[model samples]
Target: MIRTGNEYREGLKDGREIWMDGEKVTDVTTHPAFKPIVDVRARMYDMQHDPAYKERMTYRDNNKTNPVLYKLPHEQKDWADKLEAVDAVMNDIGGVVTRVGDETIGEMWSLCDGRDVLASIDDRFSDNIDRHIQAVTDNDIFHVSANTDPKGDRSLSPRDRDPDMMVHVTRETDAGIVIRGAKFETAAAYADQAFLKPTVGAWADEELSDYAVGCIVKMGAPGVKHICRSGFAGKSRAADYPLSNKFDEVEALVVFDDVLIPWEDVFFYRHTKAAQYVRSSLHRYSAFPYVLRLLYVADMMIGTALWNARQTGLDKLQAVREKIADLVCYREGINAHLTASIAAAQRSPGGLLMPHQSMLYAGRVFAVSQLQNMMHIARELCGGQICITPNADSFEADGSGEWLNKFYSLNQRWQADDRRKLLAFARDLLNSDYAGHRLTFVQFAQAPHFSHLAAVYQSFDFEGPLDFVRKSAGLSDQVKG
Candidate 1:
């Protein structure tokens, strides 16, 4: 069922333990640091009820309206519809905000595709996976992913150093199992739940390990503590840091102090193969949304650069045009990969439509690895004015206002106020502290660079190339065999 913005906001006031900047946050919906982002998420929910957006944002099943984002992909139109829904939200919000729900709900879908692997360990575990997937869609829950645990040491095992370094099953109770550890999760403080699982590690050889566990964690459950990093909002004027003030999705070190996971919530436990399968294929479907966000980022860069060039008449220069072309190539390169992936979409073992794995992963690597250089090019095109420009306050100050206006005013169209606003936006987008954090988020948020490349290597088919080379070299049939 589709929920309103106020209902989603009220859901977070469930007395969940949340801490930020060394103080407990009483209400995430009202907290200054979280309120802006929370409002953005709330607005997304409310849009589903708006007549203009209701058709695109929701679908009717059994005469009950449900969020389109939560629906499982079984066909090609399912994917296209999801893409449209996401675009509507982004356009409505006027900026990018990841982790709202759709970008993360696919992690469960990935596990659902691994039902066979899970069933091998326990048939009941496979049943749990299906039930949970249906539960999220049916309930319209806001779900996020939890994969990275704060490992104390790389060389030492959890037993040698600290058992809490990695999340493990502390004890099995009749109702469920208790867990203790911490995970670095984005939006955990405001999200309703997280699909907690193991980080990337070797687990194939072991028959059983406490570290091999996966389950659905309720964010408001007892012993779930959310210690969030200091937020960028409320730290500066909104005029100076528009994106940072409105779009920052807070990350938290979520501590699970003997939290209980009921039997129905546990998908897999004490099974190394299940853990390995999840770690390997976690991003099979989610990568589509993850990489698609970059396309908007690329457009932001292009728009900023092109506008700056137009303001100064640099668009007339051949050299300037060449750099603009470079930015376009970066933007379209991502576009091509996403488009081709959908065109060549493959059916999963679980009967769900998944983007072509090779193209999707290759797109992720290309978009993430080349982001910094693209940002640099945009920065150069924007020129040093973005950094040297004074704040909006200075432009309005009595003593300095007139002098600043005399200098900043460019032409009949470019006034001092507009110029200052543009510079401030460009600064926050490319040079501010928020800008740096966003770059790091793009790099490591999904996984490290090597992991993206590894996915590409694993998904690509090698036999076609091998066979073609063998035939070209006139090799015998015996060699082929």
Candidate 2:
């Protein structure tokens, strides 16, 4: 069932312990650090109810209204519906949001794909994934993800190091598995629950490990503490930092202090093979939306850079136009991959329509790997004025306003106010603290660069090239052995 904005906000008031800047945050719905993004998420819920957007954002299924993004991808249209739903949300909210339901929903499908393998370990584990996936559509839950741990020593195994460095099961009670440890997660403070699991495929040689556990951890559960990093919302005026003040998704180092996970919530526990399977195929469907978000980020750069060039009449210059063209090509490269991935969609193991694997993963590498260089190109196009522009306060001050007006004013059409506003927006988008944090999140938040290449390697069908070269060389049948 779909929920209203007020209903979603009410859910966050279950007394989850959230801390930021050495103080407790009583209400994430109102806290300056968390409220902005929380409102954005809430607005998305509200949009699903609005008549204008209900058609695009949700659909009727089984005689019940469910959010379009949560529906499992049984056909190619499912993926297309999801893409349009995400676009609708971003357009309504005025920015790109990664962790809110769309990007993370497909993760459970990873578990779905591994159903038979997990059933080999425990039948209940497979059932748990199915039940949880349904519950998401039924209850309209806002789920996040948790995987990375605080790695103290890269060389030491979990047993050789401080046990708390990795999230692991401590004990199994009649109630469920009790977990202890910490994880670095984004949006943990505001979301309803997280699919907590291991970070990677390497589980060492251990057949059974306490660290190889996956389950649903409620954000409001007892003993679950959210210690958040400093957020960018309240530090500066919105006029100077528009994106940060309104759409900052706060991250937290979530600590699980003997948190009890219900049996139905546990996907797998103490099975290294299960953990390996989960990690290896974790991003199969999820990565499509993750890479898709960059299309918006790329658009922001192109729109900002082109507007700056247009306002100043630099579009006439060949070099300036070429730089704009470069940004366009970058944007379109991402578009082409997403388009092809869909056009050449493949049927996954679970019978869902997954985007073409090689295209999707390769597209991820292209978008993430080239982000900084593209940022620099945008920064260059914006000129040095972005960094040197006076704060909004100076533009509003009586004495400085006159001087700023004279210098910043470009023409009758592009007056000082409009020019100053554009410069401020460009500064926030390309050079501010928010910009740098976003760049880092884009590169490392999901997985690192090498891991992207690994996915491409693992998903590619290399036999075609191998067979071609073999047939051409004429000695391959004997030599291949």
The predictions' CA RMSDs to the true structure, in order, are: 1.1, 1.0
Ten-residue segment with the worst summed lDDT in candidate 2? 472-481
For model 2, the stretches where C-alpha displacement exceeds 4 angstroms are 478-481
* Model 1 lDDT tens row, 258-350: 999999899999999989999898999999999989998888889888888887878899998898899999999999999999999999989
The per-residue C-alpha lDDT of model 1 at residue 171 equals 95
TM value for model 2: 0.99
Please provide, for model 2 over 85-154, each residue's C-alpha lDDT reduced to its tens digit, 9 standing for 90 to 100: 9899888888878989878878898899889987988898899999999999989999889989996797
- For every model shown, the clashing-pair count is 0, 0
